[model samples]
Target: MRIAAATAIAIAIGLAVSLSSVVHANEEKLDYDHQEKWQSALDRAQSPIDIVTAQTVRAEDNEPLGLQLWHTQAPIEKAEDNGHAVQVNTHATEAMIRGRHFTLAQFHFHAESEHTLDAKHYPLEGHFVFKAQDGRLAVIGVMYQVGDGNPAAQAVIDDLEAKDGKLPQPSIDIASLLPNQRDYYHYLGSLTTPPLTENVEWYVLPTPVTMSEKQMTTFLSHYPHNNRKIQPLNGRAVVHHQG
Candidate 1:
């Protein structure tokens, strides 16, 4: 009996040590330098979007934006990341503005956060990509900060339970998670991903929603360093509303 108990203890200790090592190794692999990589990647992507004055944007004609609908199982053609941990590229659906009969082609998440205004880091950031019939692209960026509880964000995290690296069915209704105000910061930028394509119309919400510290930590656990540093303004204009 004594010998059996000693053997069990030894095995348990060995298992713990092995598991610890594995966790450390994974963390190391996730340590990516955001600035260097993003700069190089952005340089490669220089496609510019047709400039349209913000004043010319027709609010009445724009389609009423809806919650993002996602499906992780629907064949992810691409999957990669920057300073962030995981970005499972998968098919998704999103409603375009009224005049724009468009839909979201893909969606992904960023850790720690990205798309900073001036100089601020949000807890997390989710990017939904919409492609127009004419090949124009508009990216809706939802900014998240640590706060109370965010049901919308929780929905996404819950669905991620069984999926870490692999894409899983996404719990959506993301529109509700967004700020009530449609006001945003519009700019011309490149996709913040690999082989960065410059053909991107960035629609960044000026207002941000809240998430719990626990929730933020949950994402950080999977991706400790998610931001891709910051990109230069490059003589670009960042337009925001005065309201």
Candidate 2:
């Protein structure tokens, strides 16, 4: 009996050591320097800019404001906690710009928004990532403030709690999550996350949608700060468009 107990203790210690090593390896893989890669070389068009609203250029009157999102038709499939953020996936979400078709592939949120409005940060920001058939990318950014709690948003948090994911990316309707006033600020930028891919189109809404304190708390609990720091505008133009 004594010999058996000693063997059991040794096996348990070995298992714990193996698990600790695996966790450490994963942490090393995730810990990366954005500055060492594409960010340093292609620094001109980085995203998460502080939009000085006063300085934004007005779109020409003759220009066509071609951005359109058919969010009502979008049906979410599943949600996953992708370490960095909770990413909600959908097979299809449609959009159109200047006669070009795009699909909203997935969306995720960042706490304490990536972009700032006249140097002010919001509680949360959601990025709806869209992709054109030819591989071009456009992202629609919506800011969330503390106000009347959004039911659809709340439903997402509830679903995440039920599932117990490492992160909570809500599988809610994109339309239900957006602000009624879609007036937006548009520009050319890069992906906030790495590879830091450039030449992406960005449309950030001026009017913010509301989520309650509880919703904010739950999201922050998952990721206290996932947002990238603000990059320089670098002669880029941000246009104000009427929704």
Candidate 3:
């Protein structure tokens, strides 16, 4: 009788333990699913696109373009690997166009080209993000490839080494880096990043800057091929300025 009682007791304990483990596993799965759904909701619900008109880029006459560097007082938060080659931040900033002022929110880099011309891919691309006072959006895209020495590219590389991922904040002069001619390839598209909002007004510079082979290699090392596949034009108009 005692033997049978002990046998039953052992079986009961085993069942109890098994039940507890199953419950724990289910709880963990629930938590993970909740997180995934929450992230998806945030992406779908947010506004990712901004409007751009002639006034967006053209500042008031005689007024210098408002651009400032965001000097880092502390370490900045960078985006995850996500296959992106360049590490960057979205801290707030301000700049002047014509006479009005606009705020710079963030900046990031893309690799192996996203925008193609005549089916040509540039080696590198940089995006400077800005927001106008009336809530208009402006983005300046600078394309780069293998060739001559570039001062601006050198400055960014230097910053990456000196700061060692701990970026300093300072106002960047947007106008100085901009090409003398305002000619560009304009189109309406969405943010290339996830939750990929299709609201971005793209202004691809007509003239691409040059970079040395070493410079291009340096960036590629970190993000060898981080670029989203190109999206369709969706019948949107693309304006090209030859001048």
Candidate 4:
């Protein structure tokens, strides 16, 4: 009887230690500022850097970035507030980049911008995430300045304005989210959020889309500060696409 009691206490202690380790692992991933726990977040090629246009080198090849994105008027699958920000998941196949064939996975917004221009922060930023056939991830970021009301963005915001958790059959215009200008800044970087995986490609549009003050206020109501702070460049070169 004494031996069995001792073994049972040892097993309980071991299980407690294992559970603590599992909880710590999850905490590291969920907390964006906990870089000490995650080495990848502290890597050299981390993303959302301050982009100084003058310092960027123009691509010598002068080849146009073959960006092809298409989206019909079909209703989006779902839009949900995932505690971080409002994200819309779509099944639309009209969006692809560089002819590599990517599906539109989901898009989310950030307040006060993520990537800054010459250390200047904008009112808002939108990230359109795409996944390739080979499992590579690419994000197209569009900055927003307070100006005329944005109809495309309003479509999504309207749904969130009414509810918080989830919105079924929300109408979002994927194509209209882009600005008229195609000029962009390209670089190799990691995801802004944790696990902070490296080797992700980033394309940032110089021209910003417009959103009114009222629209901005609505978004802020949900996520007043949802952006991750910018990371260091670590000697990475930024390629500016002139075409």
Candidate 5:
């Protein structure tokens, strides 16, 4: 009886270890610590930090964050693998964020998401990178949840399916990609990628847009893991705004 009890305990321990390995294997495919060697990545305000809702504070003046994203005639120039995330370039998409005008430079997707709400990671995340004449950048983040098929998402995904990279037909509406509700979390954070530049404004829309399983699979196939790991908050003040 004693020998049988010991053998059972050993089997259970081995099973747990095997399950743990499987979960980790399926989570990410990138070298997560690739930024550890970069000095910029070690700075005070790195991006893709988990937004702790309970800890975030409202601004002193409590002014609302006004965003003006407009439809444009500029065609989507191209969509490419970019050896990082699936990126789409736009020519004339314009944005008037908080009374300042900026042009939509390009947008990209991150598999498994870079930013997380509380501690939950979404299936996908989209970064709409806008640039001002002064070279200042303001990125609007949209999280993608698994549900109905998103037409805007499909536009890019369809191109990816046809070719490994570079869109054969460049046509997409930047406005259609965003969710109905415009509420977002405003914070001062750096770029998630290399060179990890600081002082960029990140407006992360908390509400997630829907994407079908097949669509998710198609995007993931091109780049399985492109998201950077969540960096520490480091005493930075994060604020949330209503639409």
Candidate 6:
């Protein structure tokens, strides 16, 4: 009995040490302000820029923005706190933009919005990250204002409220979260978060979605301010898609 107890203690200590090493190895905590520390973040074409509507031009090609979002009944694969914000990873749902197919990888929220419209910031912003077949990325930004209760937003909030860390499988209709109108401001930018890789295509919808005060409160309870400061435009032409 004594030998068994000693062996159990040794095993537990070994496990703890292993876990600590794993965490330290993966820890890369670059705060929103510290983006300059990374070379990629210093690029002139960085993202989360303010959309100046007056300066924006219509696309030369005038091709329709052709947004095809799949409404899947499949349950959300996972929902994670991510320490910054609540992120929901979906399955069996995808979106296409201008003939390029992109799989819906995940969607996350930011408080006070990363991108602003005419220099006005919304209460919340949702970024739907999509990965194309050729390893390119396209992010859809949806701004939200405080108003009536939104069932779709509530569904995601409920999952976060129930579990702070990683949530089990949750049923959420991601399509319902988007605005009815798909008019957007298109531009070439970088990722809002770090590594801040350039060449990412951003499509920011002008219409704001509705979320209740209670829902906003719940989200703020976790992340009061996770938005990064807007970056410079650097001669990038923002194309306006009416559709």
lDDT digits (tens) for residues 1-243 of candidate 2: 122232223222122222122111122223333533423336777888999998887665655555676754455645546677766666466877544687877777888899999999998998887766656666789999888888767756765566544444334567878888778887877677654656667889878899888888888888877778889888777777775
Clashes of 5: 0
TM-score-based ranking: 6, 5, 4, 2, 1, 3
lDDT of 4 by residue, 1-243 (tens): 122232223222222222112112223214544545545533777779999999887765734344677664546755557666666666574554544677766777888799999999987888877666555566788998888987767878766555554653367777677787877887777666655666666789889988889888888787777677888888777877765
Q: What TM-score number comes out for model 2?
A: 0.79
In candidate 3, what are the lDDT values of residues 21-118, reduced to their tens digit?
21111222122112324222123212212222331233224333332333322233433232334544444545543234556555556776666665
TM-score of each: 0.63, 0.79, 0.58, 0.79, 0.81, 0.82
Model 2: residues >4 Å from true position, as ranges?
A: 1-41, 71-73, 164-171
Which structure is stronger by TM-score: 4 or 6?
A: 6
Model 1 C-alpha lDDT per residue in residues 129-204, reported as the tens digit of each score:
6665655566777777888787755655665565455445343454655677767655656655443455455677
- Candidate 4 steric clashes: 1
Error of 4 at 14 (Å): 32
Name the candidate that leads on TM-score. Answer: 6
When summed lDDT is taken over every stretch of 10 residues in candidate 4, the lowest stretch is 16-25
Query: Candidate 3, 138: how far from true, in Å?
Result: 2.3
Q: Which pairs in model 2 have colliding backbones? A: none
- TM-score of model 6 vs. true structure: 0.82
lDDT of 6 by residue, 107-226 (tens): 888888999999999988998877766556668999998898988788787676665555543677777778989888888776776556666678899999988999888877877788
Measured with C-alpha atoms, the lDDT of residue 109 in candidate 5 is 89
True-structure lDDT of candidate 6: 0.72
Per-model C-alpha lDDT, please? 0.52, 0.68, 0.48, 0.68, 0.71, 0.72
Task: Report lDDT (Cα) of residue 212, candidate 3.
Answer: 84
Q: Any runs in candidate 6 off by more than 4 Å, and if so which?
A: 1-30, 33-42, 60-65, 163-169
Cα RMSD (angstroms) for every candidate in the order listed: 18.1, 16.3, 19.8, 13.1, 15.6, 14.4
- When sorted by lDDT, best at the front, the candidate numbers are 6, 5, 2, 4, 1, 3
